[model samples]
Target: MAQGEKGGRASRVRIWVGLFAVAGGALLVGDPAQRGETALELVGRWWPWTLLALAGLNLLRSAVPVGSLIGPLALGAVGVVGLVAVHGLQAHLVRDQLAPALLVATGAALVLSSDRMGLRTSWTRLLATGDVVVPPSVRCPVTLRAVLGELRADLGEVRGQVEVNVTAIAGHVRLTVPRASTVQVNAQGALLTRLPTRPSEFTRQPHSEGEFTIHVLGVCGAVSIARV
Candidate 1:
């Protein structure tokens, strides 16, 4: 799916989730006799996890659609496994060793396979040389990771406002999009973020129609999204 489409869907999900929470809160504050205690107990126990999974599903899917996403996805999976080992599996010793081992494995997988699908390997390799322009023909959402390099991706012809997941590790990434296109930015784990003037807050799109949603994760790197 295109970036904006995915973001729009996620946005709707957030809205519904928020409304549910508000309604639930109201119910909590209301007299308990109106409803049976059993329903309340059931929802109370599972509501938090349900919401977490609902949001996490979209976050992970949107942020890491490419094969490289497997790295972070695997990382999350390993974390869940570790939790199971520590609590469910009752393997405390394994917990101590799990983190370092998983880190090494994830790093190796990243180096070996940026995209196991092998679709955008060459295009991404251009990052090693610095300043690569995204072809207009490539309309689908893509994940770009930069290490000590730069990206010159243009979002002019992007029909869906480009759903590009950018990971900057001590690298500089630049995006050139249409001035008319509303650009929405969602940043996390960033040391710093420089966005357009009047840019909406994280996950907030003020001018969403025909806009781009760029998901950025920076580790000691910089990102700039300019309207050209």
Candidate 2:
């Protein structure tokens, strides 16, 4: 199972890399100068497409569950908002502020709808340190957000499938899980990440007993997962 997961991840990465390379090649071959346009002008017209591509990638990374729709939906909405501001309306103010406004609104909506969304625990820390431990009785999604601090989450007692979303900025995050869990990690942005590679530690585990799916976003931070 571990080998299959690795193969799938590698293939997805290859596909995305190939698509980006092709797009880059096309841009270089079709010089903006030849079209009587500056590089900025070209970017102004094509930036929405880049956002759409990212939305698609995020959707692919998401699990096949209802909770997974949130990220893609937000990204797609931002991309649509960008398109409208850049081309349909051509409002500089809207282009500059609308996407961020929408993102903030989405976050607020998530907080309001957490109960309906089956979020069991939500933790946010700014310039602080803390730990979150999930007991075996809880079987819902968990969210961890941190900025300029450290956080640790222990899921060693969780008995079944669990979903965790983590966001960190200039901080460190450590996750401890049962060794029998089949852990799947999807991450965005630059992060120093470490996970056990030894087959005996995780690869040999049966997927039916315990599972952990984690989505991570980090900026100039580190994340590590330990199996116990």
Candidate 3:
């Protein structure tokens, strides 16, 4: 059953890729005189919308978990901002005003986006290596950060609706969760992070009242969540 699901997902991904390639090919082969702009120019200005489309497509997929939509939603927001900056604003205005505003907005977004309600504890590793062991009874909404370092978190037991926010910059993070709890990983990074289609050992209602949820944000880094 898992194999069949995997195959179906792979096929769906291939279809999306093919469609994107065909669309790009059509643009490349079109007559630039009719459009008054070259294909490359159009692509440069419009590529961000593709990100928005991709995010929408992912959300439309049947297998995508609701908790996993956070990353895609953020991507879509980025796409919208990119489009506005590139297409709506003048170069001088973008550099002088929009850039600073963007930076401030990004910082604020990072702070506001994190799930901090009932935050149990926060851990940070900077230019060092560390590991965390979270007991089964631990509280929800824990935050972990790594900068130019490596970190591992072992979640022994997940009681109900446990939320973890992990961020890494030029670092690596590994999280291990118990097999008994349903696990969902919503991550954004250069590395591809796979969301669990189903719980392997213990089968329960997905997105039920209580499950393990991991939210990861990485820049030039890798984050992995494993069942054990």
- Every candidate's lDDT: 0.58, 0.63, 0.60
TM-score of each: 0.40, 0.42, 0.39
Over 35-66, each residue of candidate 2 has an lDDT whose tens digit, in order, gives 43554675797678655644443334232333
Give the per-residue lDDT of model 1 (tens digit) for 87-167: 786566455445544554455345433322312312342223233455555655666766655555666655555677877
* Candidate 1 displacement at residue 67 in angstroms: 31
Runs in model 3 deviating more than 4 A are 1-120, 188-210
lDDT of 3 by residue, 109-218 (tens): 34322332122356666554556666665555777787766667777655677888888887777778766666666654334433334413334554443476667777
Q: Flag clash pairs in model 2.
A: none
TM-score of 2: 0.42
Off by over 4 Å in 1: 1-127, 192-209
Residue pairs with backbone overlap in model 1: 3-163
Give the C-alpha miss distance for residue 87 in model 3, angstroms. 72
Q: Which residue runs does candidate 2 get wrong by more than 4 Å?
A: 1-120, 189-204
Sort the candidates on TM-score, descending order.
2, 1, 3
Residue 32, candidate 1: C-alpha displacement in angstroms: 80
